[model samples]
Target: MNSSEIIPSLEQSLITTDRDCIQLGSEEVATILVNLKSEEGEIIEEGGADVLIYAEGIEISETEDNKDGSYRAFISGAREINEARVGFRLDGKPSTKLITIRVQERCPEPFIDFERTQLIAEPPEILNDGKDYSTLLLQLYDREGRLLDDKTPVSLMANSGILSSTVFDAEQRLFTAFFRSRRVGEVGVYVSVRNVRYPVTIGEVRVVDPEPPEEEFSIIPYESHTMLQSSSLYLQAAGSPGIDSTKGIHLRWMLRGALGELHLPKGNLAEPNQTFNRSEDYVKIYRAKYSKVSFTLNLNRERPAVIDHANRLWIYRKEETREIYLYFRNAAKYDSLISNMSADINHSNFIALYHPELLEFECKDDLFLKLV
Candidate 1:
């Protein structure tokens, strides 16, 4: 009979048995018989072909050629599998059609593989102590519960900190990269994988100051005069600066012996004259010494006033009334928002009487959340 016809005949009349001629049980040892063939409808002779078998969870014990265009194989396994295949090569040519088999039998345990494997960081947050770094662990897995051998390079980047190495050897997936703090902001670490279009942020680190002390300084009034006088008033920094880039001290300008309190819209140290711009729609200054002016230094908004200073005043009668605006700004003098009101001392629609207004605002450094 031809190879195709012989295979079907042998399969129909095949007998299954163990070494003791007993029927095989579920997940137990089994001996199977397979007919070998060539592509030209000819039977493969003994020692004329090399056979191969592929089973996901099964182990092959042994195989023997029957010398009559047939082969026998012994295999044992306890894992449930859906499909298996048998292949052979004859006359220096591999078989195009492989023998497929169904291995649907009761298994002791089911096999599973990881999906969308990822690399992760242990203890995602770390102190900026400059000595210890986070450990990067590879979570890749296979159905066999073995570590997959991979050699692809992984790329790394940081927004604000320093990384010891940028390229990682994926084969030795478990590794540690040293990190150094460069500034007082949040640090983010990113990783790029092969075939991935965008990089992923894996972890973050926060660098903080170790219990900063309270700021000590004084606000020096260089020049002072009444609203009627053309002479200008200026406040300068006398000692070490009281504010940093991330925070600022509050300076409350007050007025006594006046119909309404004085409002210094811009108490800028660099340009004291801009604080008294009279043409602006906002009330830069209130009615003269008849409207008096003073200032109170506040190191902390939660605490009481630290220092207070007042300027001597005289009355002045002006032609028209000017507007006043309460301007909000950050430590870097960035204009945030402004509120306008009529400068009329009687009405004082928007101006609060002797109320503490904030001129220099505190804000967080933008570099903290910046992406590389």
Candidate 2:
């Protein structure tokens, strides 16, 4: 009985059958894993704040209960995000999601270490359409690479219908919804690690209807120069005569009363009127606005990047008393987080912003969700 004692003795002998609604075909999918304890089964609980999991999705009220079969499957992508692994598929395929992961309060230790839940579908926001801009993301990990100090909170839900609640900003792991633009159709977004003790859930889909109008020579992807977008939207492409060293001269910097374009934070672009410069506490120059040729951020560097972070502290930009000061996240950590127009500090914040979004069910793309 290896395989972790046969998966908790087959996930605690699952039973809720009329074959649990069998008769499935026409692309059937059944994955049962329910253990939220309390009806008798125990995972742990000793008090205050615990209803850890009671995930129920796949409920069909009263349509004759579908002739006693109970089923759900439909996806088309103006946006789509779904996942339940073990045999899950809506099209992308792998299947599993009779999904239940409950934990009511006290499981100090015994059995609770099963993590491998994933589903990430995003398109919630990232479209500029003002001469390029649709990729400026976020998400980095170590949620518990070992934790002795990690105030956890990773909850996101957009299971697309109308059941909403997602607005995280634990210092910019940003998830917004001032009423999510009052969506109407395709929707499903979920990601979890709430009620801690290593509880993780992932599933997503948010393809509503109201964003189609992009046609003027399209094609933009930083899908993976691989992760990094803490804040930026500067583009100024066109100017490749030499020096690429691997990809970095496609710049564009806009923000002079800016309005409809922002999310192009440092990816690969900077090399035309090359005379760039960088210097933590002061001295940054990128002069080169050759008629929309882009590169006009000469703030002369005095530290205003939300208090620099290479380990923090390096904010000092004094346009002669227009003051801003704080130094030592390595005094700008060897500057060069993307240069052009002469000046240097230690460039390597390598921007990519939350990469790994493939959830229809997965046949390829391996599944890697972290766009928060």
Candidate 3:
């Protein structure tokens, strides 16, 4: 036969050995069979031909010749889904008998769990004055009891009040709805997702009279005591005036000793204790001696006059009466050294030395002195 006649005489047919469609997530095999024939309808049994299969124009499988004029290729549905086209070639010829295979989702329906849904109205009540607002949180779950990941459209309807705005957070898988009402009554809310409507009774919000604000008070001690020359004093005050609290009462303490005038905020006074330290010359002499220390606790907001005294000494005495003596050597060096000390009184009243000779000091909750 001439080359033209021989090429035209060779024919190929492709057929699927399995179903035309595959179900997703199912481990089913799809097989294609290729047959080669002569013009006189005789099977070409002598094999050595290449056949390939493609899905969505991407090659997925290649055929193995059976040495009997028939070749086969297979694909697993579990690994691939969607529509695929199958084509076969014989002896380097162009592909023919192209067929399409389909892959479909196995589940026929999508559902959600209504019983697991949640609706919460923050503050539960809003003032009837119209300016105050309240927020509502809505949590939704799928039938598998998992948070819905997709942005499913949801609608909200109120029986009496109006929903001002709504926001959905995909990361938290919840929706926040802001609403307000000027009338004093109960506002019922209904929700709908994916065309499924829920009853208004799911969540109820109340609009009522605004309650009066309550008074609050607190006394916070200065974090640390400042050590100037020899005096260690800490300052404590009633609630942060004007900054944190609208109303605050200031207190002061009067010290009657060589340490000079020490102003302290009123709280409580624990007995002073003494300690001996031989490591530093500044505190070595006063070891184990109680320097005359006395204070009258008074609550008054009068700003004390700045007193600058020389050759004065101050001591910090804890509840156990452990004394930490501080004395000044050089103004610059003493200020630098004491600035690194800090103390925390744990909500207890502390006395701070306010002297022109001493700089500022702070104390932390855990009683430790660091100069700042």
Question: Model 2 over residues 1-372: C-alpha lDDT tens digits?
Answer: 111121111221111111122222222222232221121221111122111112233322211111111222221111112321111222132223333222222212322223423333444442222121112122424434332112543333322222223344456554433213233343333333332222233333333444533521123444522134212234445456646533556555563211123222232353332222112223234766544322222333332444344433333333433333333332232243323321224222221111122212111212223221
Clashing pairs in 1: 282-323, 282-324, 282-325, 283-323, 283-324, 288-291
Best by lDDT: 3
lDDT of 2: 0.28
Predicted structure 1: lDDT: 0.37
* Candidate 1 lDDT tens digits, 239-322: 236543234433333332211223344423334332232334243534333343333322222221111111111111122232
The better candidate by TM-score, 1 or 3, is 3
Tell me the tens digit of each residue's lDDT in model 3 across 189-210: 7665543334435687899966
Where is model 3 more than 4 Å wrong at Cα? 1-111, 211-372
RMSD of each: 25.9, 27.2, 28.9
The TM-score that candidate 1 achieves is: 0.22
Instruction: Between candidates 1 and 2, name the one with more favorable TM-score.
Output: 1
